[model samples]
Target chain A: MAPVVERAREVRYATAAELPEAIVGADVLFAYDFFSSAIPDAWPAADALEWIHVASTGVDAILSPELRASDVVLTNSRGVFDEAIAEYVLGQVLSFAKDLPRSWELQQARRWVHRESERVAGTSALVIGTGQIGRAIARLLRAAGIRVSGSGRRARTDDPDFGTVTAQEDLHEALAGADWVVCIAPLTEATRGMLDGAAFRAMADHARLINVGRGESVVTDDLVTALREGAIAGAALDVLDTEPLPDDHPLWDLPDVRITPHNSGDFVGWRDALVRVFTDNFARWVDEEPLRDVVDTSLGYVPTDGSAR
Target chain B: MAPVVERAREVRYATAAELPEAIVGADVLFAYDFFSSAIPDAWPAADALEWIHVASTGVDAILSPELRASDVVLTNSRGVFDEAIAEYVLGQVLSFAKDLPRSWELQQARRWVHRESERVAGTSALVIGTGQIGRAIARLLRAAGIRVSGSGRRARTDDPDFGTVTAQEDLHEALAGADWVVCIAPLTEATRGMLDGAAFRAMADHARLINVGRGESVVTDDLVTALREGAIAGAALDVLDTEPLPDDHPLWDLPDVRITPHNSGDFVGWRDALVRVFTDNFARWVDEEPLRDVVDTSLGYVPTDGSAR
Candidate 1:
């Protein structure tokens, strides 16, 4: 915000109840933490709103019916998360394969337990969603010698990064033989609650699931049941249906589950990088030029056309 | 042992005290935990020992003065541990970079802290030892997009795995800017206690050290002091000078040190793989053919000549 203030633009910062008055004369709105519904509640006062930029990849929270019906240009920060999230996925995968959690447990007990671990090389990974984040995960995992397969909304056979991407309908078959099932798909009607009890049953008994995408994409109750029943080996979740995971959440107490505070894509200097992306896009917006990372509002994300504009 | 018993050969299993009588007419001796020094004590009674195979990569335990003076061939299970140990190194590297240890600590406290992590890609790693195990670590770390440099007994510029292998004389120079210092060198008189207090002080403040090769290669007292004073960030030690690390050891109580019971090279099926190496060599011995993984006993490990044999 200080950097934006230095740009000689009048910026109005307001609370949820004060947003309506602040948005009355604003031509552009920067929705930081767009997951909050305060922006939509103040939508009627956005009379001069020409563009709305979200500081996140997922726009499900800010996608109001009125905004979708309006002519306001919607944009998101897309490429900012690729490498960071990919590193998180690899970290969790290696942790499970090497049993680092158990190693820590033994360390705390002062027990010098010698246990044989599993190797990551030659193991199979089924990465759901072939977007920039998913492709990044596949690339890094492949480098570590994991046999990577991807699944997207439509089957893609020509992707060099994710070999022979299976169609979304065939996800179950892909799940059967995979040693890891990583979900990085965007949240949408088609993807919500996609990983239910049946999906868990389709996965190998020794397979582990990693969710770095939206929490709504997985059925939390079903995951708990699967973990309790020993249907899958374990799960490492960076996102959940509820933020902070609620202090009383059963997921926190589960021995087979590892919870991270929805921070998979965060790295040092992330805020500066996010600000840079927005400021660069803001420059183009002010000059009446086509903006970069323009989200396709109909699809709720930027289309994979390999374009920055 | 079951496979050897089923080979239709006369086999006598005995304790270290009884090994002399058992070795009277034995053509082959399988020293499965030869570190006990009992084999050397019973060496006088081995009248017909032609070959001895140690079920581990390190030949230090069985490198007795009498054995070195004798004509008996010595071999070790080399290739079996290369991949498993490499995986272990990578797991620790990723764990440190991603702050998984801190994440686990937060989980235990039920604290949902969102801390930014460091990126592994584009980071620098200095891997000591250019043998098969070191090469394997370099290969995997390189695959994960780390800038990997290696050190060996003598500098070699033609190596493909590590760009330019640094000589042992310049190891401290190699440690100056490295984000990770991985010691996978064999245990030899020249390499023992190579990583001392001075070496730790030369490392970057945020650098982490991983020792999977041998405990004696690093000075444990110096490492503990370094960790206490924050000379280096942390360390993950799979090999310690003492096996089972004694319950009262100070290393066990250090928060910055991660201790595993010298099991970095251990993986599921490792024992079976060791037996396979021995049984395969046994067939060669029976046919009067050269054995595989013949250790250059003078050097304490197999000399890397780019050959599987």
Candidate 2:
């Protein structure tokens, strides 16, 4: 409701390393802080700039004091990676259901093994943090005939997006009922280490946990223990507390755990998608139209804010 | 028009190996002699058998001269595995599209490699053999926003089941336009080697082939050649010319090939589904009603005679 708008006069590109230099003289500044070798020394003035867009969805690192204090509009590429990440989640689920890895091993040994697999239908999914990724995950799960729920900062009884909505304090109740627990919660102060030993213990033994969000939201040691003790059936992680987990990392040796580098939403055309979203926001800024997917910085994300857009 | 209706008589359980012993002593015997550990040597007499329901949709082995001489009702498990097979096909398509195998490799190395992936939403699929499996394939494809067509031995333009029902000779046209070619044809003498070098050449360079019906319906050597030469993009095979493709088989080494041990329609509770179908048929037989999915000795399978129920 604070209505922080941008009035563009001149543009600056403060990306870490070399970039396409296409927006040299435009009245907009585009930055790729995530891929840069070093941070830019100088910051753009807020009053002189009308729009500021980050290439990555998570703006925690790039949210400098000047960018925050300035009244210019701030938007991140939120919806660009939704479909790709959703597809990745579906692929991992199917790969597990179909026992593809075991089949690959059997093929290598020329052993004609016949293993039965479970279906995705009639399952229940609890998606923590009802953000873009969470919504996409819910849509795909629903399409697969699974009932889905959501857990957020506040409880909402009338929200039709989730069959069950539980407040953050009641996360355990939601975890206990979920057949598939998907962690897409932002790594905010309130949600950090949210899924720990207690939450894992509350999960159904047959449930599968998938994390495509921040790794800090889950306690890695507790997840490993849950998997080892069969507290939960299986898990697929695309993000870890530490990027490029060491080869000797104990997490790699877990039997029912799937570990991937944090590339779930990073597709080949992803850069272009980010640019497209930013360009659309840029066009909207010049027209004095309200921007989409603005970060709260205080609440970690803009609240459903009545519109649910 | 041939009503092969037999009298109340004995039933032999030749396919007892594939099915459970509980299915024996049935008024209508299901002779599933497919890859069984030899025939049930202590089987009941043929004279007492009122009907011989084959577990497999194809009855090539059971359609012998002696069995044909009898008036026993010969039904097949035609519709039992359609949905399961369709799910398997969808799994393969998604796996290929999302680059699951490559992701699996990168996960092992703890490397974050992002790549572009194709979506199946707007592709065209050509399903050969417009039977239960073919119809199921079309339905799933339609759900995924894909256009689908089917070709059969007999052409029927008025049939809504297939977008383009063409004769066997017109298969080239079907293959030429298809982005995916699914072969579920019966393994009659005519269908054997139907997908040979010429057929592969006719397919689009980006098309993929999936075979779930019968192994003998495709030419293994020609298929290997097509994949190796990039005549067609890739293939996911459930059934093959050999049950367990020998360690030395060349098809196993093909880069674009995915080989499974003929378990496309196999999943958890699949046995229950087969039993359920058989139980329904058994009830109909007890009521002296016409059976469904009766095998047309000439065409392999068709609906039961119009007047028999």
Candidate 3:
């Protein structure tokens, strides 16, 4: 970013308010803050805007009818978060399977209690997205000997990463059979609030949910009701609908829920890695070469050929 | 055991005290409580004993000079614990690399702080045993892309699971290069109190130790001091120098130390699995077939050809 700022002939910086004026004649708009949702507000002033490069995965925040209809090619930082997020999801899975939370409590009480733990090798997991991040999660969990399938936009079989890809419409059927459910779908028209009461009821009572995707993908109220009613055994959420979840939030004191701030894909050097992705994509745009991680505005994600890697 | 007991003409069950009299007319002895030291004391009365089977791994507790010098064949439940223990160790490794303990602390207080986690894929681990359980750990960690090596009784290259197995004498040199040092070695004359002050000092300050081996494998005081001075970053002990560690013990509340009762290899059906192991070996012994999991008493564990599977 320092090098790009130094080398450019003209560079304009703006907050959400100033973005309208600052974007007046810009050929390239770099949405450094991907979550700000400022791009659409300034879309009318982007007279020369040829492209918009977001610094994070999930371009839902910036996507709108005007931008999607316009010819502004959009690219996202995809690869940077794959491995880190995959590791996080696997860690959360193991935490529940091994009863690590109870162990922590016992350790605090100086209690030496022995309990039998469970194994993931023979368990089944259903990943709710088929994008890069979801594929990464599938690969990692499969590596641990867990059976992995996907609930994607369409149903298919013999996928490279997820052997069986069930269409989103069949999510309930898939949920009923899985021991673990992971949500990594983007916040989109059909995806938002997908995990409601019905979905929870569809899951086995011993099943657990791990959400590293958008918080809105799950219905918060339904999740609370499900937890209270013992619809699911536990949940480990990295993303929550109401983040920094209010201190009085009941999920905080729930019997078997684990919460962490939304930093799942963030590992040391991630910022540099994201910058490198942006710079590399920028160079490709400048050279008129094919860009990587190009998001199809209509599809809302970078489509894959049924292969995880 | 029920089926066997129902058919036998002279079925005998005994407490440790009665074990001496029980041994007077026994042809085969099954040491159900593996940790009991009654075998050596009962050895003098074992006039007809031909085989002894222990319902656990780690024959160290029951191994005695008299029994070793006797003609009685020693067999242990070895294969039962491999995969279960491997899963536990990997879960523990992820727990550390992902900062789960601190996440638990933050979650309890309803804090939403974001912090970067670490990946084990590119890091290195040194497993301090080359037996079945240790090799299982090596295979699992290596699958996650960690560079896995071994420290055993001998130094060799091209070993199946661990590419290069360092000799036990060079443990200090090996410890210096490892980010995670896992001890799964059995307690033997050479291994007892092996991880002392010099060993901890030899490890990098950022390195962490995980002991799933034996309580006596590490010197507790030295480990406490090492953790205090940051000689090593942290530790996760499934087996400590003292079981049910004393309430006032300083190690209990140490900043980064996590303690769990010694149940790393025990899973939901582990007791049944152990019984199956013993029963299967008994059937083989009665038929005069070569015993399975035969402990080379002098070597102190079941020797492997180095293949993890």
Task: Provide the TM-score for each candidate, comma-separated.
Answer: 0.96, 0.84, 0.96
Full-model lDDT for every candidate: 0.86, 0.71, 0.86
Chain B TM-scores per candidate, in order, are: 0.96, 0.85, 0.96
DockQ of 1: 0.76
iRMSD of all candidate structures: 1.0, 2.3, 0.9
TM-score of chain A of each: 0.96, 0.83, 0.95
Q: Fraction of native Cα contacts kept in each candidate?
A: 0.74, 0.33, 0.70
Model 1 chain A: worst 10 consecutive residues (lDDT sum): A300-309
Distance from true position, residue B192, model 3, in Å?
Answer: 1.1
Q: Report the Cα lDDT for residue B266, model 1.
A: 81
What TM-score quantifies how close candidate 1 is to the native fold? Answer: 0.96
Clashes by residue pair, model 1: none
Clashes of each: 0, 5, 0
lDDT of 1 by residue, A265-284 (tens): 88887888778888888889
Give the winner by DockQ: 2 or 3. 3
TM-score order of candidates, top first: 3, 1, 2
lDDT of 2 at A303: 53
